[model samples]
Structures are given as structure tokens and as C-alpha cells.
Target: MRDYFIRRLLLIIPTLLGATIAVFFITRIVPGGPLEARMRQAMAMASERSMKDAGGSLSEEQKEQLAAYYGFDKPFFPAYLIWLGAAPQEVEKQFIKFEEGQNEAKVTLKTLLPRAQWTATNAFKVSEATVDRKGALTGPDVVGWKTKAEPEKQRVTVFRTKFNGLLQGNLGVSTRYNDRVWAMIKERMPVSIFYGLITFILTYAVCIPLGVIKAIKHRTVLDNATSVVIFIGYAVPGFVLGSLLVVYLAARMGWFPTGGFVSDNFSQLSVSGKVWDLTHHAILPLICYMVGGFAFMTMLVKNNLMDNLAADYVRTAIAKGATFRGAVLGHALRNSLIPLATTLGQIVTVFVGGSILIERIFDIDGFGMLSFQAVTDRDYPLVMGVLVVSAFLTLLGNILSDFFVALADPRIRFR
Candidate 1:
């Protein structure tokens, strides 16, 4: 088992590397980029300034400089490498010299060499050139230059990659929120975990016992009635149930807060008061979150238990002087729980993913809402950060599920 677990853990490295490579290239190929978004914002601001006063737009040179500043001028693959912190940082310096003669000005562009070897190429069109007071060309001519560089062993920084910051527990800054991605996620994670814990606890606590009872009762009225109720809960979506609960329980009866995870002055309240306030605000959302899971879990437990009860082992146990109740409990119960045990890992992952529509409806600022906003705003850093975390959890969860399945069933062994 130890060797099996170690092998499974080791497999995660290649899986994560492949996932990151796919995500990085796919995100880069998307139409709009941060640089373009920044340019649009700049243009809008420029337009607003023009309306207020005699304003001007950014020049071509200014645009090029902005692109370079943001590292947009580099090829996507190279930029990706730099972002990953696997490539060396390069800085270029250029100087243009002009000499005035009788009719036209002589133009020469020179690029300073860096530690890395580079080839420089320049293109200029001298449509009409006039010499300035400093003997520099001042005309409508265009000049463009590009340099290609190969880093030396001493020049390249081997430790830099886009994930370097992530490795150090930093999620980088949000381009949209203007704050640290880690800070934003940290602020919202509690809301998700709180409701997730409550939902998980309530669902299992209620459903497991109910499922066992339903299985024991089999085709009786009690089983049918419970099935009907579970189906109703399953049929209703969490968002729909949330809205209904808000209308009937919150608006009509005024038994709970309509939405939100806590009161504005919750910190000022006594400990018990704070707890009451939290539970009051959470009731509707918690109910909504749990209802969907309850029906499915109950049905799963019922079916698994019922099948195990009818198995040959239970019949043999009953024939060997075991009471019906003892046969079900001692011979069938443990095996019945194996299926549910496999799902434990997935439940853990759901805590982090949260429910987007549910959070939005309740006005809860959680990971789900943050992810939604990040995607819509194209905040790549935050989006990637969330994705990486989610992917890691999902992969880890599957591995954990395997361990759980092995634990639950002694017959199933890991080599």
C-alpha cells in the first residue's frame, strides 16, 4: 500500500505539467489579451480627456513602448517562458544619429550589445527629412528596428518560470482587482468552506441513516414516501430552491435573513449572538446547497445497502444462526459503505469549487464568485491561479478516492 501510494503521488507531477502546458498555450491563443485591454482603457481615458480639454492621443512610439514595457512585443512562446521564470530578462538600448549635409540628412541607428549575443536589423524610409537644430532628423519618415538575442549560460536565469511565484505561495496580483490574487482568494475562501462544511455534514448525517432505513423497509410505504421526498429535493435546483426559500421563509415568515453570510456588525455582537446571526443568514443558502446532494446520496446509500442485503453473504450469515438485523448490520453494512467512501475525495474538492449561482444569489463573496469575475474580466493571473489550484485538488481527490476505496474493501488490494 505504501509503495502504491508513492507511485500514485509521483504520477501527479507529469499530469500537472501536461495540464499547465495545455492551459498556458490555450490561454495565450485566446483573442483578447491584457495589453489590448489596457490599450482600450487608455483610449477611453484619452477620449474623456479630449472631451474635457484639448487632449492628445498616444503616439506610435508610445504604443510600442507600452507594448515592450508589458513584454507583449516578445513572441508568445518566449514570453510564456519568461512568465514561467525559465528565461533570462533582456533589456535593449537604441540610439539614432543624424548628420546634416547640403540637401539631405545622413541617418544611422546603432544598438548597444548586451551580455547575450544578438543580431540587429533596422529599416528606414527617408521620404522627406529636415535637419533639426541638433542636426537630428525631424520629418514624416518611419524607422523600425528589431533585435533577436540568444542568451549565454551566464546571462540566463535558470530559476525563473511563470509558476515560480506560485511555488513560493504567491498567486501574483490581479490585473482587474489591483490586489494580490492570494489575498482576494483568502478573503473569500471562508464563506465557501463554511457553507461547504455545513452542507457536507448535514447531507451525510441525514442521508446515511435515512438510506439505511429505506433499504431495511424496502417496498413499504415508508420507503415509497421517503423516495418521493428525496426525488422532489433532487428535482429542484439549488438556485431555484434558494429563491423560493427567500420568498417564503425570509420574506413571508421573516424567520431568517434574506441573503448574505453574516451581519454588517457581526463582530460587535456577543459570541452567541454572532453564532446566531451567522446561522440565521446561512440557513437559506445551506438548505439550498444541501438539498441537491441529499437526494442523490440517500438514493446511493439505499441502493448499495439494499443490494448488499440481498447478496449471498447475507443469506449465508442469516442461515448460520444470525438474526436478520445482525446479518444486515454485521455482514452487509461495511461493504455497502464502500461506494460512498469513494466519493469522499470529490466532496472535499467541491468545498473549494463552491457554487457559483448559489453564491451570486445569496450575495456571498466566495471562490465561485471570484472565479466568475476573473474569467469575465480576463484576469489571467487570478484565473490561472484558481485553475491550477482546482486542477491540483481534482487530481489529488481522485488519488484519495482510490485510497478510500482500498480502505473500505479489504478484498481490493493495491500491489
Candidate 2:
């Protein structure tokens, strides 16, 4: 079992690589990218200028600057490698001038706060130039010589590269929001986690017991009534249910808050007040989030338990002077839970976020909403950043499910 898990863990690297490579390449090929959007904006501005005087298009230098700014200047593979932190990311070019009178020349170079070497080329001779966090130049004295004898103002461009990507814990910056991608993801993660955790706990907590009761009381009025309700919930989507709840419960009856994860002054509340505030805000959304899963999980538990109860071992246990509760709880219930245990790991992925439409309907700022906005705005960095976290979690969840299955069923063993 240990060796099997080790192999699964190692396989995640290549699996994730293959998945991300497809998505990374697709982002590059897609239209309406950052560069195109910038160009459209520039053209719109130029059109406005045309009304005032004459139309002006972006120059080649301006286009190249835009391309470089969005990291679109590199080829597909190099850009992907840089994003994975396997290749160095190019920083903005800095220039230094060697004047005739100045004895010592100092130039401030922009860096990602890491120690890096800046090489000067074209009409300048620089040896081993390095910059610290404070942007101070170090190393041997910088010397410059021109082709002409007379000393002249010689401008030399410095090239610098930094390894900033997934390996470096940098997800790049969002082209749309102009913010760090990981920062945005971190900011919205909590809201989704709160909803997801609550939904998971409540779904299992309520569904499992209810399923047991239904299975035991099969063909009774209690079972028939609950089945109708469960099917209704299964048929209705979470977002649609959320809308109905908001309208009827919030808009008409004024029972619950309309939408949002919390109140405006949530931070200012006392401890118990904060708890009440969260509960108050959570009621409607939580109901919507749990409804769909509640139905399916309940039915799954009921059917599995029923099947196990009818098995030969359960009948034998009951015939051997064991109580009905013992036969159900000790023997049948354990076997019935194998399917649920196998799927338990998959539920972990929801810690990142909930349904996008449900989030939009509730006006909650969560990871799901961030992902939707990133894709809609064509924010490549943010999209890829979200994908990286999500894909990793999903893959890990699958392995976890397998481990859980092994634990639930003693007969199962990994080779």
C-alpha cells in the first residue's frame, strides 16, 4: 500500500504537466488576449484623437512594448518554460550612459528583489555587474569605450533575467486587474472554503442518518414523503434555488439576508455576534449549496445500506441472536459506507470554491467568481494561476479517494 501511494504521488508530476501544457498552449492561441485588448484600447483612444486632430496608430516600438509587458514576445515553449520557472523571465531593459566628464557611473536597475546580474552590451564594456535588493550596483568598475577617439555620450542597454514562476512561488500578475494572481486567489479563498466546508459537513451529517432511517422504514409514509422532497431538490439547480430563496425569503418575507458572504461591519462585531452574523448570512446560500448533494448522497446511502442489509452475512448475524441494531450498524453499515469513503476525497476539492453561478447570484467574492472574471477578462496569468491550484487539488483528491477506499474495505489491498 505504501509503495502504491508513492507511485501515485510521483505520477502526479507528469499528469499535471500534461494537463497544464494543454491549457497553457490554448491560452496562447486564444483570441482577445491582453495584447489585442490593449491594441483595441489604443485604437479607440487614437480614434478619439482623430476627431480632435489626426488619427495616430501605435508605433512598432509601442506594440513591442505591449508584447513584452504581457510576456507575449517569446515563443510558445519559451513562454511556457518561463511560466513554469524552468527558464529565466526577462525583466525590463535599463540604460546607462558613459559621459565624458563623469568618473563613476551609477545606474538603478529594476529587479524582483532577488540578487541578479545585469550585463551591459552595445558601445559599453561592463564586467560582472550585480545588483542587490536596494538596487545598488556592485562588482568591478564599469568601463566604456566608443569606436571614435573623442569621448561622447554612449547609452548602453542592460539585460537582466529573473526566475519568477510556479517554482519561485510567483503566479505572475493579472493582465486585467494588474495585481498578483496568487494574491487575488488567496484573498477570495476563505469565502469559498467556508461555504464548501459547511456544505460538506451538513450534507453528510444530515444525509447519512436520513438515508439509514429511510432504508429501515422502507415503503412507509415517512420514506415516501422524504423521497419526494429529495427528488425535488435533486431536480432543482443550486443557483436557481438560491434565486428563489433570495426572492421569497429575503425580498418578500424579510427572513434572511439577500446575498453576500457577510455583513458590512462583520469585523466590528463581538465574538458571539460574529457567529450569529455568519449564521444569519449563511442560511439561504448554504441551503442552496447543500440541496443538490443532499438528495443524491441520501439516495446512495439508502440503496447501499438496503443492499448490504439483504446480504447473507447480515442475515446470519441477525439469526445468531444479534440485535437488529447490531446487524444494521455493526455489519451492514460498515459495508455500506465503502462507496461514500471512496468519494470522500473528491469532496476536498470543493474547499477552493463552490458553483460559479451560485456565487454570481449571491454576489459573493470567492475563488469561483475570481475564476469566472479571469476567464471573461481574458486574464491569462490569473487563469493559469487558478488552473494550477485547481488541477493539483483535483489530481490529489483522486489519489485520496483511492486511499480512502482501501481503508473502508479490508479485503482490498494494493499490489
Candidate 3:
């Protein structure tokens, strides 16, 4: 069992590496470079105030600087090499001579930062040189200006912020937000994590029992009535459902908050007040999101249970001496899990990224909301990060599904 678990866990590294590579390539090559994201976001905020407002418009020169900082100025292979934790970056710069009296003074520095070597955020190496004010250059690639300042006087220190560490790994900073990529991940992920947990529990709680009972009492009036409800849930699109709920329930009953995270100043509220407000806001989105997964799970579990009813072991167990309850719960249900296992496998992929439409309609502040913003904002890093996370979850879901199936079925063994 330990060996099996270890092998399964080890598989994740290569899987994630492949996903990372694919994400890196897809994000870079896709139309509308990094600046497009920033531009779009700025426009979104400003456009609220104007008929149409362009925010933080970038010049061609500024665009070049942004690209250089991200090492997008480098060849694609070099960019990939840096991302993959390989290759020494070749640097660039020039030399300038200042005629101070008869004795001439020369300094080696960046073309951009005249007094210093501009530390490119994700750069491999930046060659230092001298260029005149008009933009002409002279001399060696490495900084070796003759100076009188002592031991390291000859050495020019480029602005070297910590780039490689546990925190700052291969992936560069976000093109949209000014902060580090990892930092953004930490800040934004909690909302999604909370969202995932809450919705998942709600979905499963409503689905499994409903499915089991419907299966146990197949063809009854109760089953028929339940089926109609489930059908309606599955038939209606999440957005349409959310809007209807919002208009009828929220607008009419005045029971739910329409938008944003928590109350405006939830911190100031009393403990119960905070809880009440939080639950009030969350209920509508939760109910609407649950409809899709819950209804589907009900149908899936019912179908699987029906199939398991005919499994050889189930009938054989009953014939031997087992009661209906024992035969169904102890034997058939165990086999039934194999089908539910597939549904569970799909959960991570489907649920994690699934509620986008619902969240947007309900105005829920979660990853789904961020995704909606990313599309409109055209924010590639946020979009790619969210997508890569989704892909990772999907792969994880498949792996877990296989492991669960093997664990549930003792006859199956990995040699």
C-alpha cells in the first residue's frame, strides 16, 4: 500500500512539470501580450467613470522595457530554458567616458539605468556597457570601469534583488499585477479554496442521499417527483438559474446580498452579525452552484447503484444468507462506489473551475469571479495561473479516482 501510494505521489511531479511547460508556452505565444492585460484592467476600472477610458496606455518604448524585464526580449528557447531552471543568461550594456579635466573617467553600467545596472526581474544575465546620451556605445560586455575606490572599486554592483529562493522560483512576476507571481497566488487562492470547499460539501450532501433513495425506491411516485426536480436542475443553465433566483428570491424576498465579498465593513460587525451576513451572501451562490453538480451526481449514483444491483457477488451474497439490507449495503454499495468513483474523479476538475457562469451571475467573489475578470481584463498570468491550477486539479482527480477504485476493489492489484 505504501509503495503504491509513493508511486502515485511521484507521478505528480512529472505531471505538474508537463502542465507548467504547456502553460508557459501557451501564455507566452497567445495573442495580446502581457501589456494587453494591464491595459485591459486599467480600462475596466476607468471605463466605469467614462464612456470609454484607456488606462495606463503603454508606449512602444515602455513595451520594450516591460518585455526586457520579463526576459521576453530573449529568444523563446532561452525563455524556456530560464523557466526550466537551465542556462546562463548573456547580458548587454555599454561604456561612457566623462572628460573630467585632462584625466578621463569612465563607468560601466546599464543602457537603461545610467548610474546602475538595471536588474531585470527574470533576466539570466545583463551585459554592462557604456552608451552616450544620444545612444551610442563603446567597450567590453562585462562591467570593468577603472576606479580608485579600493577592493571592489573596479566592480559595479547591478541592482540584485533576491530572485532565486523557495519563494521566487522559475516563474516570473505577473504581467498584470506588480507583485510577484507566487505572492498573487497566495493572496487570491484562499477565496477560491473556501469557495471550493463550501460548494463541494453542499453539492455532495444534497446529491448522494437523494441519489441513493431514488435508486432504492425506483419507479415509485416519490422517485418520479424527485426525478422531475432533478431534471429541472439539470435542464436549467446555471446563469439562468442564478438570475431567476436573484430576481425572485433576492429582489422579491430581500433576503440576500446582491454583490461583493462580505458586508462593506464586516469586521466591524458583531460575531453573530458577521456570521449571519456571510451566510446570507453565500446561500444564493451555493444553492445555484449546487444545482449542476448535485443533480448530475444524483443521476449518476442512481444509475451506478442500479447496475451494481445485478453484480454476481450481490446476488450470490443474498442467496448464501444475507438479508436485503446486508446484501445491498455490504455488497452492492461497495461495488457501486466504482461508478461514483468516476464522478468523484471528475469533481476536482469540474467543480474547481466549473461554477464560473454561476459565480458571475450571482456576483460571488471567488476564482470564478477572477476568471471572468481575467477574460475581460485579458490578464494572461491570472488566467494562465487559474488554468494551470485547474489542469493540475484535473490530473489529480484522475489519479485519485484510479487509486480509490483499486482500494475499493480488493480483486484489483498493482503488480
Candidate 4:
């Protein structure tokens, strides 16, 4: 079992690699990326400044500068490498003064590559170049200097690349929000986790015992009534239920807060007040989150327990003078839980897998909502960051599920 688990752990690398590679390449090939969006913004700004028809596009030089800034200047593989932190990326640029003479001042810039290797084929292709008043390179094409003419004393831009990305704990920045991807994730993670944990705990706490009761009271009015109620809940989606709850429970009845994770003045409230406010706000959303899962889990437990109780071992245990309750609890219940163990590891996704629609309806800022925004906005870095975290968790959850299955059914073994 240990060896089997180790092999499964090793397989995570390739699994994650394949998933990320496919997504990374797709994001690159997709149209309307960050570059195009930025260009449109620039064009809009230019149109506004000139107060003219929006027919003009950015110049070639402007496009080149934007491409380099966004790292689109490189081909697919190199850019992907830079994002993975396996290859260096442009981090900073600064122009340096080399020589100062009465008549002429000489400045030199370094490329990302070695100075000696790049000097000959450099964009400027000259030993020395003078800047014009307009901040453009006056000499032959210079590598780092602006293509536009600039003042002689203008500060020239020199660029430097560095090894900084996923491998270095940098998830990159959001193109749309202009914020660190990790920071944004951290800010919203707690809300999703809170919802997930509560839902998980409540689902198990209520469903399992309910299932056991239904199994023992099979075909009775109590069991049939519960089955009807749960099936009704299972038929309705969580988001739809949330909308209904918002309308009747919050808007008309005035019981719980309509939306948001907490009250506006929660910070100023006392500890007890804070707790009550949080609970009051959480009631509607939590109900919506748990409704679907509650029904499914209850049914799953009931069916599994019923099947196990009818098995030969459980029947024999009861026939051999063991009490009915003891036979059900000791023999049938443990075996019945084996199937549930397969999904136990899914608890990980709960950290970030709050229902997007449910969260949107509730006006909650959470990981799922953030992921939805990232994809819709085409924020590549943020999208990739979310994918990385979510993919890892999902892979890890599968392995944990397997481990749990093994634990629940000792009769089972791995080679």
C-alpha cells in the first residue's frame, strides 16, 4: 500500500504538467489576449485626446513596446518556460551613462544576453548613439532605447531579465486588476473555505444519521416522507434555491441578511455581536450551498447501508445472537461507509470550489467567483494561477480518496 501510494504521488507531476501545458498553450493561441485589449485601450485614449474618429491604430513601435512589455515578443515555448520559472524573464531595465565629454555624452545599455555577444547584432548596431529631444533613438536601431526621437539627456530604458515565476513562488500579476495573483487568491480563499467546511461538516453530521434511521425504518411513513423531501431538494439547483431564499427569506420575511459574508459594521461589533452577525449573514448562503449535497449524501448513505444490512455477513451476525442494532452498527455500517470513503477526499475542493452561481447570487467574493472573473476577463496570469492551485488540489484529492477507500475497507489491498 505504501509503495502504491508513493507511485501515485510521483504520477502527480506528469498529470499536472500535461494539464497545465494544454491550458498554457490554449491561452497563448486564443485571440483577444492582454496585448490586444491594451492596444484597444490605448487607441481609445488616443481618440479621446485628439477628439477625432476612432480610426487610428497604434504605431509599429508602440505595438513592439507593448508586446515586449507583456512578453509576447517570444514564441510559445519560451514564454511558457518563463511563466513556469524554468527560463529567465525580463524584470527590469535601466539606461546607464558610459562616458561624459564636453561635446558628447555616450550612454550604453545591456541586453538580457551577454553584452559582448549582443553588441554586434544589437538593435542599435552602433558603438554610440545620441537621443533626440523627443525621446527616440537618433542612431541606427538601438536595442533598449525608444524608437521615437527623444532629448539628448533623456533617460534611456535598459532591460534586464530574471528567473522569477512559479518555481520562485511568484504566481505573476493580473493584467486586468494590476495586482498580484497570489494576493487576490489569499484575500478570497477564506470565504470559500468557510462555506466549504461548514457545508462538509453539516452534510455528514445530518445525512449519515438520517440515512441510518431511514435504513432501519425502511418503507415506513417516516422514511417515505424524508425521501420525498430530500428528492425535492436534490431536484433544485443550489443557485436557484439561493435566489428564492434571497427573495422570500431575506427580502419579504426579513429574517437573514440578503447577501455578503458579513455585516458592514462587523469589525466595530463586540465578539458576540460579530459571531451573531456572521451567523446571520451565513444562514442563507450556507443553506443554499448544503441543500443539493445534503439530499445526495442522505440518499447515498441510506442505499449503501440498506445494501450492506441485507448482505450475508450482516444477516449471519444477527442470526448468531448479536443484537440487531449491534449487527447494523458494527458489521453493516463500516462496510456501508466504504463507498462514501471514495468521495471523502473531495473535501479539498471545498476550499476553493464554492458554487460560482451560488456565490454570484449571494454577492460573495470567493475563490470560485474569482476564477469565473479571471476566465471571463481573460486575465492570463490570474487564470493560470487559479488553474495551478485548483489542479493540484484535485489531483491530491484523488489520491486521498484512494487512501480513504483503503482505510474504510480493510479487506481491500493495493499491489
Candidate 5:
């Protein structure tokens, strides 16, 4: 198992790399760039100010500066390299000489060559030069032969991409939120986990026992009634149920809060009051999240248990002087849970992804809603951050589910 785990962990590197590459290029193919969006926002603000205070729009030089600031002036591949922190920032510096009689100063475009050589072009021939202590030249030998003025330095970014983004825990900044992507995710994660964990716990707690009962009372009226109830819950979508609950329970009866995960004045409440307020706000959203899972998981458990009960080994156990209860509980029950155990991976994935529509309907500011907003706003950094986290969890979940399956069924082994 140790070796198996090590190998699986090592395999995640290439898998994640491929996933990131796909996400990066695919997002790039989207219709608009972040710089363009920023420009539009700036123009809109300028327009608003103009209407109120007679302010002018952004100048051409200001527009270029904005493009340069965001590194949009460079080619896509070079910008991508810079983003990955793969290359150093390139700066443009110009050397100017003040001639005695010339109207304009003699300007020589000098850039630091790859080997630290100062290469000057589009200027007069070199006559004399002075190198500084650091090998940086103060005065270059020029044919124009005059006093030197202050050199102009303009910084431009190149291959500056941070390849260690995932490793170093920096997921980059969101253009839409104007904040770090990780920070935004961190803020929203707790709400999602709160709802997801509750749904998971309750779904298993209720469904497993209910399934066992239904399987035990197969073809009885109780079983038939349970089937009708769970199927009805299953058929209704969580968003639809949430809307109905809001209209009937919140609007009509005033039993629960219509939307949101907590009261606005929750912090001012007493401890018990806080808990009650939280539960009140949570009731509708929690119900919406759990109903679909409850129905599906209950039916799954029932079918798996029923199949295991009819197996020859279960019959053999009962024939060998074991009580029917012992045969079912000790032998059949264990085997029945194996199939459910395999679904643990999917559960982890769902926990991370959350329910987008349900969260949007309830106005819960969870990870799911964040993702939905990111996609709609074309926030590439946040979108990619969410995708990376989801992908990692999915891969990790598969490994965990394999271990769980191995533990549940003694016949299953990791080599």
C-alpha cells in the first residue's frame, strides 16, 4: 500500500501539468482579454465622471501605459512565459548626448545584451567609453563626441511566469474581483464545506438505515411507501424545491429565511440565538442540498443490500446454524456496503464542486457560486484556480476511494 500510494502521488505531477496546460490555453481562446475588460471599465468610469464633472477620457499614452502595466503589449507566448516566472524582466534604456549646436539631443537606444555587453544602435559611432566598477558603462565611446545627459530607462516584463504557483500556494489574482484568487476561494470555502458536510452526514445517516429497513421489508407496504417518498424527492430538482420552499415556507408562513446562509445581525445575537438564527437560515438550503442525495443514496443502499442478501454465501451462513439476523448483519451487511464505499471518491468530488444552481438560488456565497460568477464574468485566474483545486481533489479522491474499497473488501488488494 505504501508503494502504491507513492506511485499514485508521483503520477499526479504530469496529470496536473497536462490539466493546467489545457485550462490555460482554453481560457486564452475566450473572446475577450482582461486588459480589454479593464479598459472598458476605465472608459465607463471616465464617461460617468465626464457627465458629472466634465472630465476627459483616457489619453492614448495612458491607454498604452495600462496595456504595458498588464503586460498585454507583449506577444501571448512571451506573456505566458512571464506569467509562469520562467524569464527575467527586460528593461529598455536609451542613452542621450547633448551636442553643442544640435537642436535635439543625440539619442542612442542601448539595451543590455545577453552577455552583459552594452549594445547601442541607431546612433553615432563610438569614440570613447567609460565602464563602471560593476562592468556597467557610464559613458559609451560615440562619434558624436559630446556631453552626456541623463539616460532614460523604461522597464518591460518578459518571461516572468511563476511556475511554482500551485506549489507555493499562490493561485494568482482575479481580474474580476481585483483580489487574490486564493483569498476569494478561502473566504467562500467554509460555506460550501458547511453545507456539503451536513448533506453528506445526513444522507448517509438517514439513507443507510432506511435502506436496510426497506430491504428487510421488501415488497411490504412500508417498502412501497418509502419508494414513493424517496422517488418523489429524487424527481424534484433542488433549485425547484428551493424556490417552492422560499415561496411557501418563507414568504407565506415565515417559518424560515427566504435566502442567505445566516442572519445579518448574527454576531449581535446570544450564543443560542446565533445557533437558532443560523439553523433558521440554513433549513431551506440544507433541505435542497440533501433531498436529491438522500433519495439516490437510499435507493442505492437498498438495491445493494438486497442483492447481497440473496447471494449464496448469505444463504450458506444461515444454513450453518447462524441466526438469520447474524447472517444478514455480520456477513451480508458488510458485503453490501462495499459498493457504496466505492462511491466515496465521487462524494469528495461533489463536496469540492458543490451545487452551483442550489447555491445561486439560496444566495449562499459558497465556492459553487464563486465558480459560477467566475465563469460568467470571464475571470480566468479565479476560474483556473477553481479548476485546479477541483482537479486535484478529484485525483486525490480516486486514490482515497481505492484505499477505502481495499479496506472494506478483504479480497481487494493494492500491490
Candidate 6:
């Protein structure tokens, strides 16, 4: 386990390095800027005018300045290396620092200036109360007070982040939303995470057993009917299913929310009532993700189980007086699941890392929503940041998938 962990950790370096390179390259292919972002929006006329105006005479200097401000100044490989190696990994540290012996350097005003006396250690205290003596940052008071400091103690943190640099729960700034990416992700994540997870659970619970049952029953009415149903689920696309569910279950039947994360008046409701409202809103999306989601997994499990059932060990178990149920659920289920269960580790990130269309359809504000907007708006840096995140997720998923292989079949070892 120790060796495996070390190997995985080592792998993350190149994984992130590659992600940085890919993200940087991909961003350059996209053009436009902050004004262009607003103007290109089909929904906003003023922004479109601004974008068109900017596009006509965006000077080389202006383009370069924009690129530099957003960290697109360097050649792709250099930028990737710099971002991976030197970018500061925290939000509160989003400040510029002067180099040692470089006398005239300064932190720019546009940067997230520390509110008076914020420190790496004392950042959390910033929201409420005065700074302790030991932690006070000495800046000129009242808009120009100048206090000299020890050159050695004068480092300011920067805000650029990468995968290997990701702190636990570090959702970076939302380049599109004009809010902390973490906050945005938090608000929408609960909706999708809760909905997707519940849906996943319901899906596997229902489908796995049903698949097993159908396989055992073998072309009886139960088996035939279940197969037909599973085929239908497999046939229908997720978005179509989601839309239909919204119309029928939520809009027509009025059993669940039609769209959106919660009712507008949820906050005004009592705590229990708010919870009830959230649950009601969640039901439709959850059902949507689940109803169409299960067939692939179910088919994978049923086939794997049936294949195992014909294995020598399975026949041997039957020969030893094991009942069909015991052979199916106890021995075969455990063995087959290692292969199938690996998928969970991969899918676990989908709620957090992807789901752009689902977020759009539901109008839920999240990383997915930001990513989608970034593409349409041509906000390159923001789009690259999201791409980097997606790459990390894919890497992490691959790592767990490998680990699952090891756990499922002990003969396989992690190097």
C-alpha cells in the first residue's frame, strides 16, 4: 500500500504537468476578452456591441496586456512549467511579491490586496475582528501611509493554481461568475451531488438486482419483460429522458420540481420547509439521471456475473451444494464487482467535474455552468482553468480505477 501510494503520488506530477500544457495550448486557440465575453452573449445586446467594437481595433499591446494579466504571456511550454512549478496554490495568497534585491517592485492595486493585516496564517481571522500584534501586516494607513518592512519577510503570495497544488476542497475562483468558484460550486454541487448520488444509488440498487434476477430466470416473463425495459432505458438518451420527466412528473403531475435547484422563497420558509422544498426540487433531476443511467451498468454487471457463473469456481461452488442464490450473490457478486465497482471511482467525479448540459438544462450555477459559459463566451483563462480541473479529475479517476483492479484481483499488484 505504501509503495502504491508513492507511485500514485509520483504519477500526479506528470499528470498535472501534462494538464497544464494541454490547458494552455487549448486556451490560445480561443480568442476574445472580458468585453468580448459580455458582447458575444446572444442574450445581451450591449455586450454584443462592445465585443464588436473591441474586435475591430484590439491593438497588439492590448492583446498582449490581456494575455499577461491572465497569465498567457509566456510560450505554451514555459507557461505550463511556470504554472505547475511556481503558481501559488491558495486564494488568500493572491498577491504579487517583489524579488529579493529588486528594490522597485510593487504589488499592483488591481490584485486582491490584503485587507489591512491579512497573513497566510491569519487569513481566516480577516472576516471578523482586529489583527493580533504578531500577525499584523504593516501597510500605509488611510490610502498612502508607508511603513518599511524587512526585505526578507516581504514575500506576497500569488493566486494561480494547478492540480498537484490543489488543497483539499480548493475550488478556485470562478473566472466567469464574478464569485468565488468554491462558493459557486458549493451552491450547485449539493444539488447535483445529492441528486446524482441518490440517482446512482437508486439505479444500481434497482438495476443490479433486476439484472441478476433476469439472468437467473432466463427468458421467463420476468426475464423477457426486464430485458425489454432495460433495452428501452438503454435506447433513450439522458437529456430526452430528463426533459420528459420534467414535463410529466414535475409539470403535469406536480409531484416534483419542474426545474431549478429550489423555490425562490425557500430561504423565507422554516428550516424544515426549506429542506422539504429542496427535496421536492431534487426529485425530478435525480429520477432523470437514474432512469437512463442504470442500463449500461446493469448490462455490464449481468454479463460479467453470467460469465463468472460458467467459471470453474462457480460450477465447483454448485457442486459443493451451494444454492443458486448463494453462488450468485455471495461468490460471483463479490468477484464480479471489483471490475464493475472500479467504475464508481471514475464516475464519482462526474458530479463535481462535468455535467455541463445538465447544469444548463436545470440552470444550476456550478463549475459545469462556468465551463459551458467560458466556451461560449471565449473567456480563455477561465476555460483553461476548468479544463485543467477536468484533466485532474480524469487523472484521479484513472488512479482509482487502477487501485480497484488491485483490490478486486489480488494477483494484480501496483508498481
TM-scores for all predictions: 0.77, 0.85, 0.72, 0.83, 0.77, 0.71
- 124-158 per-residue lDDT for model 3 (tens digits): 33354443333333457534323212122222212
- Residue 306 error, candidate 1, Å: 1.2
Candidate 5 regions exceeding 4 Å error are 1-3, 45-61, 71-78, 81-164, 346-351
Clash tally, candidates in order: 8, 0, 8, 16, 15, 3
Whole-model alpha-carbon lDDT for candidate 6: 0.61
Candidate 6 local lDDT, 6-81, one digit each (tens): 7886888787767666666776665565544533443254453444354334544445444555555567666554
What is candidate 2's lDDT per residue for 378-407, written digit by digit as tens? Answer: 999999999988888888899999999999
Kindly provide the TM-score of model 2 when superposed on the true structure, using C-alpha atoms.
0.85
lDDT of each: 0.72, 0.82, 0.63, 0.81, 0.72, 0.61
The 10 consecutive residues of candidate 3 with the worst lDDT sum are 148-157
In model 2, the runs with Cα more than 4 Å from the true position are 48-56, 94-108, 112-157
Q: What is the C-alpha RMSD of each candidate to the true structure, in Å?
A: 10.4, 6.9, 8.2, 7.9, 9.5, 8.9
Per-residue CA lDDT of model 4 for 339-382, tens digit only, reads 98988999998767788898899889999899999988989999
Deviation in Å, model 6, residue 308 alpha carbon: 2.7
Kindly give the stretch of ten consecutive residues in candidate 5 with the minimal lDDT sum: 153-162
Error of 2 at 392 (Å): 0.5
Candidate 1 regions exceeding 4 Å error are: 48-56, 64-71, 88-164
Scored by lDDT, model 2 comes in at 0.82
Off by over 4 Å in 4: 48-57, 93-157
Clashing pairs in 6: 39-47, 39-48, 140-145
Give the number of colliding residue pairs in candidate 6. 3
What's the true lDDT of residue 321 in model 2?
Answer: 92
* Candidate 4, RMSD to the unseen true structure: 7.9
